[model samples]
Target: MKQLLILGCLFISLGLIGQSEEETEIKNTINSFFSSFHAQDSVGMTSVVSKNVVLQTIGANKQRQQVLRQENFNDLIHAITSIPDSIKFEEKLLDYSIQVDGPMANAWTPYEFWLNNTFSHCGVNSFQLFKQEGQWKIIYLIDTRRREGCANQP
Candidate 1:
């Protein structure tokens, strides 16, 4: 009975370790994508996404009607790269909520967008990922952006 108890504890510890590792890897994958974004490196951003990844944004149109804007990955990359060097922007991500099941996971990140060190908007990002070939790759991404109803903090 004593040996069995010890083995049981060992297995539990190993399971916890596995979970910790998975969380770390998931966060790392997300961080890598942002790092690439801040650097304006299209290739780096593309490296972490699956070929068929979907991108969308939630925003209000000119008529104030809410709409989902689906974006092409390449077009986004082009836009980012085209930004003038004189301007600087960043999406500061706050907390991350993650869940995993087998080979898929989802992460929710609340963020503030800053332009030239001034807060422009705040929103949340939802990222869906798939474990492919032993690595996590982003499969879908959607985010909300709002100027009002946001606690803009530096």
Candidate 2:
């Protein structure tokens, strides 16, 4: 009985450890998404996202647009490259919640983007990630952004 209990505890501990590692990897994947954007690394960004990825942006002008497929990817690459390298945008992942079931995961991360040290916007990024061949890749992303009023604090 004691041996059985020990084995059970070991199994539980291993499961917890595995979960912890997965969480860390997820966070890294999220971080990589932003880092790629900041660096204007099109290839790097594309590698993490799904081939049929969808991106939607809500601009300050109140215009909502959707980007799909290769055209979307090209547009993003162009937009990022157009930005002057001096105009640094720093993204902070303030909070994230993830749900995993089998080979699929969904994550929501509340984030703040800073441009030249000033808070530019805040939003919650929703991501649908799938485990493909033992790797996690973002299948869809829909992020909504709103300007930060003075009343808001990051």
Candidate 3:
């Protein structure tokens, strides 16, 4: 009976190890995407995302009404890569909350957006990913944007 308990514990440990590895892979994929974003490397960004990826944002319009805006993937890539060399911007991720089930995963990241070293806004990004051919690829991404209730604002 003692041996059986030890064996069961071993199996449980192995399962947790596998899950941890998968989580690491998922985090790496996200980090790679952001690295490419900061570098303005379109190809690198595309490599980690599905061809049919969808992007959206939750924000207020000019009249202060909440809206959900869908963005074209190609257009977004163009906008990011078209930034002038003199302009500086970054999305500083504060934390990550990731969950996985089989081949599907979701990552929630809270972030602060900075432009030219000044605070621009704060938000949370939710990413949906699928495992394709043994690699995680982002399938959908949506984020909220707001200027209030952010920590560390000056």
**TM-score-best of 1 and 2:** 1
Better of 1 and 3 by lDDT: 3
Q: Give candidate 3 misplaced runs (Cα > 4 Å).
A: none
How high is the lDDT of residue 124 in model 3? Answer: 98
- Model 1: per-residue lDDT, tens digit, 14-39? 99888778878889999999999999
Ranking by lDDT: 3, 1, 2
- In model 1, which runs have C-alpha deviations exceeding 4 angstroms? none
Candidate 1, after superposition: displacement of residue 73 in Å?
0.4
- TM-scores of all candidate predictions against the true structure: 0.93, 0.81, 0.97
lDDT of each: 0.93, 0.78, 0.95
Model 3: residue 88 alpha-carbon error in angstroms: 1.0
Q: What is the lDDT of candidate 2?
A: 0.78
TM-score top scorer = 3
lDDT of 3 at 126: 98
Q: Which number leads on lDDT? A: 3
Q: RMSD for each model, in Å, please?
A: 1.5, 3.7, 0.8
lDDT of predicted model 1:
0.93
